[model samples]
Target chain A: MRQFTATYKLFLQHQITKGRLTLISVMAAIAVLLGFIIGSSGGDTREGAVVLIMGYGINFGVPIIALVLASSSFGQLKEDETLVYLWLKPSSRIATVVAAWFAALSAVIPAVAIPLTITSLVASSFDFSLAGPTFLAISLAVVAYSAVFSFVGLVLKKALIWGFVYIFIWELLIGNLAPGTSKLAIKTYPTSILINMTDEDINGDLTGFFVSTPAAIITLVAITCASIALTAWRLQETEVA
Target chain B: MTQQPPPPSSSQQAEAWPPKDSTIVARSLSKSFRGGLVALSELSVAIGPGVTALLGPNGAGKSTFMRLLCGLTKATTGDIWVAGGNPRKDAAVRGRIGLVPQQDGIFERQQVYDFVYLAAVLHNVDDPQSATLRALELVELNPQELTRPLGSFSKGMRQRAKIAQAIVHDPDVIVLDEPLNGLDPKQRRHMIALFHSLGEQGKTILVSSHILEEVERFGSHIVVLSKGRLAAEGDFRSIRSLMDHQPRKVKIACDKPKNVAARLIESSSIASCTLHDEETFEITTADAGAFRKEIAIACQKSDSLLSEVTPLDEDLESVFRYLVGER
Candidate 1:
């Protein structure tokens, strides 16, 4: 526990700068503003917000926020050779990986959840059906994306560049090209959670991406656990400078 | 033609390579990088407790050897045992080893207390706060400096901070690579004293340095490396005696260069002499030890005010080359 606190505090200190906070805040404002515009139009406001979230939130916002913060957690540590300081210790490597994962989650959760909450409120005008499912989808997406990106941060140099490529090529492009391939995309699970939980008739565009709730939840858990375990393995196997 | 001796077998290496109450041992250790640059090759050594200096030129694999021992890098081929356990395989064994790495990659934004405290926690120190304070105090860093960010401190202060963190956990083995690189004279003395003290307390402290004179203060036990291979290892005077047989280039600046040169060659020490100026001359000697002793007496006899006697190839790097060539 002491090991986790020390690693967690130090890793968190490197992130959470004024600039990142401002950027995340700006992204949230954009999500809320567009959701409000859809709300004022007065036609299927809940369904409209879900569509906006599915397009803007699931496809872009959640992944981007996760990418920036989670990847930098370990990526910057490697870039600067500070990883050696952390790597030399007697503490379990899993604790360090999980601490970094949690440190990233500490910021990612608020960064992701607050904006999504506001946008859902602005779009649905205080309805649980819209806000609740929207929150669930993003919350699940945050867990999966943070774990995967944290692993990416540990394994690759210029992690953000690779992260952006994966976002574009795998999640956005390849994800939509085939229904079968969508099962592999990280964003697809949240897309499923959002579509299957909400009014299916209203989300005609996203209705095709829906998988069963059990499958989506199971996949997200599998991805998060696998990412954490793989990260620990990498920390053990690779040589530190 | 003279026959070159065969390479020592692994068993022979265990007995011969400074096996003074041996604790850290590397057998048949070799490491090659991606681009075919071999960092360490067929290196074998046994370093026991005390202040043993690792001498080599830059790119001579001193840092690489240290990294492999600390389990920071994987050896291409070899087995290393630290404190009766291979640090690479035994994560618990790493708790007993500390490293002051060559690269200065510490978290510079954190205050000194935070930095050392993190190391203590990672090492599972019983009371991290007291341990951190004791470490900082040992390195002579004042209480007031604890709150300052590491980047804000001077080079000497930063070096002490690095040392403090390495020693914070009080491990059995401490590996320091060029540990005194940035310290001032006083700080270097303090650090050297601290290392000697640690060594006295039964801690194995392996220090690395390229400067011959700087390392001379680190006691007599030494290990010399050339191009990733063990050139020589033993008492300092023993290695010096081996090197004494090599021809040395010596330069003298004095009042009577000709007279000094004339008296210096009387004992067959000088192979040849060349006078560069009225006050300066150079000589190549078959026996450096003989010439070193003869030069001062020769200068005094000639009634010359001895200004300087400099050995052109006396640097540790040059010494390694000379030793490697002779072997």
Candidate 2:
């Protein structure tokens, strides 16, 4: 709890003054504003729907935020040579890592989720029934994606590059082209949930792009748990090199 | 040849008084990184109370030894105990020890009070507010700086804040790895005084430093390391006596160097003398104080003024080189 409070204080400071954090928040706001403008244009509903979809896609910013936050989590300690102090402290490593992850996650989730939700509501005419489930799916997606990226952030020195590759190359390219690989992408499960909730027909003929409801929930839970477990294990095993 | 007194017994030596009843013991500790880069090699030492200075040059395993003692990294093959428990297995042991690492281990964006208070809370201190205030006072930080972000602090202020955080929990033993690194002369003096007070308060402190004079000021017990080995251990006087045969170099600047040199050569106390220039001479003496007094008397009798008399071999580097054999 002490570690959590300390890390949260650090996050609050970063959210207020850090340029990159401000940039991410601004980009999220701009993306949401663009979505609302296009959704309210009232010419072609399909185009408006496309804009809303883009807004949802911009939810990728959550993972990016996680990457940025986690990249510095332990890396900053090493760079500043402050790990020695913490390593000598009586606090548990698991507690510290978890606290840092949650702190970073808190900074990011709201930036992406709130903006996206507000835009979707204003643009789509207050369809709470549709928006509610979409929000749920998006939140789950944020948590799952952040967890996985946070683990990657701990493991790799070049976490931002790896995070980009994971989003663009692995999720976009391979998950789209190879039907079998889609299940591995976090977007696959949440998109499935969103599709089920909104009755949206995405990738019409792309069988295996989506899975059953139970499988989606199970996959999300499994991946989240596994990423957290990996992070804890890595914290214990790897020396602060 | 002259015979010297035997070194003091272990019981006659100053005993360290730990703030609490706990002994930090290490036996046959060794550490080697990948590619066979050895950091500590079969080194062993015990620390109980008071300020024990771990003196060593760079890469002499001071940091590595601290890490091993704190259980930050596992010893390749050895055993360590702190507070009657294995540091690796016991979190309670850590609660009794405070570590101030070489680098300022602080989140600079946070305020000073918040940082120190958070550390106290993390260490399970019952009253964080009083603990934080006490710690700030201990470091002599201005109360106004408690509300300011650490990033804006000067180097000495940051170091004091770091020390404040390290001791907020009031641990029995405090390990400071190069606690005086970048401080100015005033700050250094202040910190040295602070260390002495902490020791007087009965907190066992293990401070590491490469600077001999700084360590010499407050180091009640000294453990010297050279190339990852325990080169010397015990009080400074005992260690100095170990190198009794090492000649002391004295420089004399006088008006008549040749006359002084000629006069000094006749005395058995002078081992050798060299003319540095027309007005200066360097002499090797077995007893530095006695030789300096003799030179002063000789100058007075010859009616010559002695401009300067200095001991060149009094510094630690000279003693270290004599003990370790120059690399």
Candidate 3:
């Protein structure tokens, strides 16, 4: 337990550096600013919100932010060669792996959530109903993205570049039109949750793409567990010093 | 002083290398990386309690072997045991082995105290704060300096901070890979003293270095490595003798070098001489100490003033080559 907390605290410090905090703040403000511009422009506010939410948030902004933050959890440590300080200890590898996953969350949640909330609300022309779905969707997205990226960070070299490819090519572009690959897409879960909860009038490319809420939740939860397990196993096998 | 045992054969190494009271043992260890780079070959040796130096030239697999000992890397073959447990297989065994790595990658944003304290907590020490204080004190880092971030420290202080973190948990076996780098002479002396004290406490402390003289100061016991293999192990004297008795080139700077070279050519110790200019010359000597005594006498006879005398082949690579060749 102490080891877990120690790893958690250190990883949190890594995430909340002044430079990164400023970068995340800028990204959040820009996302909100884009949402506000479309909402007040008077051309179908709900559709604009969906474009920003599904197009930018789900497909681009959230995953990219989560990728930089999550992958850096172990990536930066290994690059700096400081991983040996933690790796040579007697503590359980899962403790460190689990703690790193949560610490990435500790910053990732707040960094991605508030902007998403303000973006949806203002973009929906002060629709308070948008808050519930926005929060739930972003919450699920960040947790799932953070776990997968953390494992990717551990196993893959140049993981940030590879993660970018996965998000841009596989998740957004291919998952949009191809139903077979879309079944494997992570964004489908959160997007389905938003479509089901936000508004019955919410319709577009998402009309035929929605999975049931329970199924979506179960898949995301399963991915998080599986990613964490793989990370722990790789942690033991890695030759770090 | 421990006497040199006969060089053990590959088959005999298992029985003859590390004796009964070995604290760390590696048998037939080999590690290879991509591109066919073999860092450590089929080398085997055992180290017991005390400050035994891990001596080798750069790229002699000292760091690789140390990483293997600390469980930071897996062995390509064979086995290694620290305190009767394999650190790679047993997480609990890592608590007993503390490592001071050579890489300069400490937490730069963190204060020295916090870094060492983190190591203490991770090792599950009973009281991290107290252990941290004791470790910092042992390394002689000032209390006021503890609050400063590690990035702001000079190289020497950073080295001390690294030493503090390694000792914070008071592990039974400590592996230091090139720990003396960046330290000034005074800090080096203090560090040697601290290692001596740790050795007296019956801890197995292995300090690795490429420089022969640096290893000599830590203690007479040394495991000399060359090209990923054990070249020699035992007392420092045997190795020192081999280094001293080699035919080495000595350069002398003096007024009237030609006359002095003429006088020195009479002696049997001077195997050959090359007069470079009006005031300088070089000699290849079969007997270094005898040549030193003869040069002064020859200079006086020729009425020449001697300015300097320096050895040319004193680099560690050559010494390692000599050892490897001799063995």
Candidate 4:
């Protein structure tokens, strides 16, 4: 338990010192501003709804932030050669990975979720009841994306490039162009959650392609579990060098 | 020092420590990379209490052996046990052993105290704050410096901090890979003293260094590796004795080089002597002291001036060359 606390503290220290918190804050502020401008702009209520909908679409920021944050956690271990220190500890590999993941997730949650909730309320001028589900969906999406990207970061040396390709080429491109590939992309499932949260009557066309909320929720849970398991396996098997 | 019985044969030594009782034991360990690069082959060693220096030159398989022992990489074929258990399966083994890696690994943005405290936590040390403080004090790091960022530290301070982290948990064994690589002479002296104290406390410390002199300072037992094989292993004097018969070089600048050479040759102490210019001769002697005395007597008899007499092959560089052959 002490080891876990120490590892977590180190993770937090690394995140704070690396300017991750500051970066997250800046991104969230930009996201909030973008949400407000798009929400208030003159358009049909349905079009204005898509604009207001962009706040919940903060799931888009989830993979980007997670990819950047998660990819370097273990790579930094390798670069510093501090993996030996961690490896020599009495804690299990799974525990170390989980501790790091939880620490990073905790730091990023406030960074991503707080701005999202604030922006959603400010931009739409929406009631708490209307924003609640969207907030929950975005929060879940952040955790799911963090887990998946953290796994990628732990396993690959070129995780940043690979993460970029995953988000841009696979999630954005193939996810839109093909239905099968969309199921494989974490973004597609979270986007479905946002589609459910938006006023379906006002924006039927935009939400048409998304799966049901229950199915999206199931996918998110499954992917989160799978990502954590894969990450644990990688953490155990991978050599420090 | 009273000599213990000759160390058990490699195989017997491997099995002597109860698999469940030894701090570390490796038997017939071998590892090879792709492209047929054998990093270690049939390497066997057991490490217990006190400091053991893994002495070797560059590319002598020290790093590979360390990685194998720590279970950072799987040996191609062998068995390794740490604290009476397989390290690969037991995370607890890591807690029992502390490693100070060769690289400077502190996070640039982290305060020194936080960095070491984290290591204590990782090792599951109770009361991490005090443990961290104690570790810092052990390394003799100033208390004020603890709050400062590690990036602001000088190279020597960073090295000390690295040592602090490794011992923070107070593990039974600490492995330091080139722990004194870049320190100035004073820092090196401090580290040597620190290692000696650690050893006196009965902590098993394995320090790897290419510099023989540095290893000689702290290592009670030494293991030498050359080109991925165990070149020699034991006390320094025992290893030194392996090259006992190697020709020792003597440089003499005397008034009568021919007379000195002749006396040395007559005594059968010198294998060969080559006169250089008028006053100097380089003699290869089997027994340097005997040849020196013989030359002294001959010079006195001839009333010849003996300007300089020096043993050219008495230092470590010559000893290493004689033992391992010049690269």
Candidate 5:
């Protein structure tokens, strides 16, 4: 527990800063303003808000924030050669991986969740129901995205670029367009969960990405656990600089 | 060539692990990296408590050996025991071994105090805050400098911070790879004193350096590696003597150089003698001390003044050259 606290504190300091915090807040405002614009421009305010949440929040904001935070968790340390200090510690390898994962999750969660939830609320014209489900979906997405990206950060050198590619090509492109390939993209699972839990149809866009709640939960949990384990195993076996 | 560790006595076997005499022991250790690169090969050594210099040129496997001892990388073959148990398999054993690597891998954005404190926390020190302060103090880092980001620190200050982190936990064994690199002369002297003080406390310190003079300042004990092999071990003087086939060159200044050369050539210890000028003679001998004494006696008998006798090939540089074949 002490090891986790120390690593978490240190890793968090690397992530959270005045500029980053302000940028996240701005992203949140952008989401809210976009939803308001889409609503006041033409159609139902609730529908417009739900469309912005699914379009900008889930498809863009959440994954981008997760990628940045998760990749920075281990990638920065590895690049700086400071990973040796953490690797030489008496803490269990699992603890190290999990601490990094949690730190990334903590950073991305706020940066992503508040913006996403506020966008949903403002888009829906202060409807609590839409905001609540968006919050749940954002929470679930952050966990899966943080774990998978953290694993990539540990395993790859240019994790940030690869993370962006995965977000653009796999999550946004294949996840929405290709029918069966959505299973390979982490964004699909959280989108499926949000669709199943919420009433906002948003032009029936969520129907194509729908999966059973149990399957979505099981897949997310599996990806998170497996990625964390693989990261810990790699750290144990590899000779880091 | 491999040298077996001294067999443990009955009392030692019956007592606890580590055998008390040895702090680090590697048996037939070897490491092969990817792409068919073998960094270390079939090397065996036992290191006791004190300052032992690890001397080798680039790609000599010094860094690999240190990493193996610290459990950062596992050996491809054989085994290693650091501070009593296997650091590779046991976290407890790793806690007792501190390593200051050669690379500049510091958390540059972190404050000096936070960086050292994080190390203390990772080592599971009893009181991390106090231990951090003490470690910084030991490294002689000013109290005001503790809060500044490490990126702002000069190279010497960064080196001291690295040393502070390594010694923060007060481990039983400390492996420092080129710890003296990039330090000013005064800082170098201070670090040498610090290493000597740590050794005096019975802590095993294995420091590697490219500077022979600095290594000499540390101690006489050294482990020399060449081409991923243990070329020589023990005091440099003994190793130099072991390589007796190499001729020792000595320059002598005397009043009658031709007379001295003629008389010195008759001695069995003198391999060859050449008269350089009127008052100087260059003599190559298998034994320098005996030849010096013989020259003194010969000059006394002949009424010739012997001014100076300098042994040209007795320092660590010559010994290292002979072992590594750099000469």
Candidate 6:
């Protein structure tokens, strides 16, 4: 547990640099601004608000921020060879991966959540109901995305490039329209949870493309667990110093 | 030091090689990378608790062997026991091994204290802060330098900081790979003293270098590696004597190179002489000490001033070549 705490502290110290904090603030502000514009332009109309939040905020902004944070969890350290400190420890690989995953998740949550909550309130005509559910959905999304991306970061060489492909190609393009392929995309689960929980009157509805609420929750948990497990296994088998 | 007798009818006795008191034992170790490049091939040796210098050229698999011992990587085919535990199978055993890698992997944005402190905590030390500070002091890094970001540090300070991190946990075995590469003469002397102190404390110190003199300062115990194999392992004197028949070159810069070279060649100790220039010449000598005395007398008789005399082929690579060729 001390090892975990130390690793967590080290990861956070590396994460909360001035430049990254500023980037997070700017990204959140921009997402909120986009939400405000969409809400005011179509005043009290839930369809325009839903379209903007789903299309721009959830689909694009949240994933990008999550990807950056998660991919950098072990990627940057491995690239710089500073991962040796953690790798040569008496602690289990499971602890190391868990620490990195939690660090990335914690860092990504606030960065993506502030904008998401603002978008939710503005889109819901100042109604405070959707904020809680939206934040919950986004939090789950960040957790799953962070773990999977962290795993991808460890396993792949050019993880950032491949993360971009996974987001833009698999989730953005195929998951929306393609029939069989959409099931393979991770965003489908969290998006389903969001669609089911958010105000239902919005006309730009993406509810049909999602799985059931229980299934979404199960899949999200499964994805997080599987990714963390794979990361630990990969760390044990592979050599990096 | 007297060797401890092997435990009779024990499982460890079956695999023990190069002796019973050895802290690290590698038997028939080999490592090959993805492209079928064999970094280490059928290597076998045992290392005891002392300052044992691992001498090798650039591609002689020194780093590969060190990494294997550190358990940073596994051997493709052989077994290694470090501190009575297999590092590959036991993660906790890593706490007993400290490695100063050859690569420059400084956390540039972090302060020196934080960097070393992190290593201490990861190693599960009882009190990381105090251990970190003690390690820093051992390496002779001042308090002011500890607070500064590592990127702002000079090469020597960075190297010292690295040493601090490696020793912070007070491991049983410390493996330093080419640690003296960038240190100045004073820092090198200090580091030699530090290594000797650590050895006095009964820590197994395996320091790798390609320079013979650097290893000579630490102690006589030497391990020569060449082309992914153990060429020889023993005291430096014994290893040097193994290649005693080879002609050793000594270059001399004198006032009258021609006359001094002619007089030096007259002695039986001098095998051959090559005049490099008007004031400089090189001589192949079977006996370096005798040749040195002979050269001084010859220069005095020739009325020539000998400015400098340097042993030209006393490096680790040359010795490795001789040993490998003999094998």
Tens digits of per-residue lDDT for model 2 on B170-246?
88778888888778888788889988888878888889987878887876578777788888766756676566567
**TM-score on alpha carbons, each prediction:** 0.88, 0.83, 0.84, 0.85, 0.91, 0.86
- The number of the candidate with the highest TM-score is 5
Report the Cα interface RMSD of each model, rounded to 1 decimal: 0.9, 2.8, 0.9, 1.9, 1.2, 1.4
> For model 2 chain B, where is the 10-residue window of minimal lDDT?
B1-10
Q: What is the DockQ of each candidate?
A: 0.71, 0.33, 0.62, 0.59, 0.71, 0.55
* Candidate 5 clashing pairs, residues 3+ apart or interchain: none
> How much is B313 displaced in model 6, in angstroms?
7.1
Per residue, candidate 5 scores C-alpha lDDT tens digits across A174-232 of: 88775588888887777777777776665464466678778988999999999999999
Supply candidate 2's per-residue lDDT for B7: 29
Give the per-residue lDDT digits (tens) of candidate 5, residues B195-312.
9999999999999999999999899899998888888888998888777788998898988888888888899999998888889988899876687689887898778998988777
**Residue-wise C-alpha lDDT for candidate 6, range A13-56, written one tens digit per residue:** 66667867777788778777877776677556465555666676
> Chain A only: TM-score of every candidate?
0.95, 0.85, 0.94, 0.87, 0.93, 0.92
In lDDT terms, how accurate is model 1? 0.85
Cα-based lDDT at residue B86, candidate 1: 72
Best by lDDT: 3
lDDT of 1 at A119: 87
Tens digits of per-residue lDDT, candidate 3, B208-275, equal: 98666677678888888888989877665556456667888889999899999988988999989998
Show the colliding residue pairs in model 2: none
- Considering TM-score, which of the candidate structures 3 and 5 is the better prediction for this target? 5
Predicted candidate 6 versus true structure: per-residue lDDT over B32-68, tens digit per residue: 9999999999987889998999977778899999989
Q: What's the fnat for candidate 5, on a 0 to 1 scale?
A: 0.78
The parts of candidate 4 lying over 4 Å away from their true place are A17-22, A43-59, A199-208, B1-23, B249-261, B273-283, B286-317
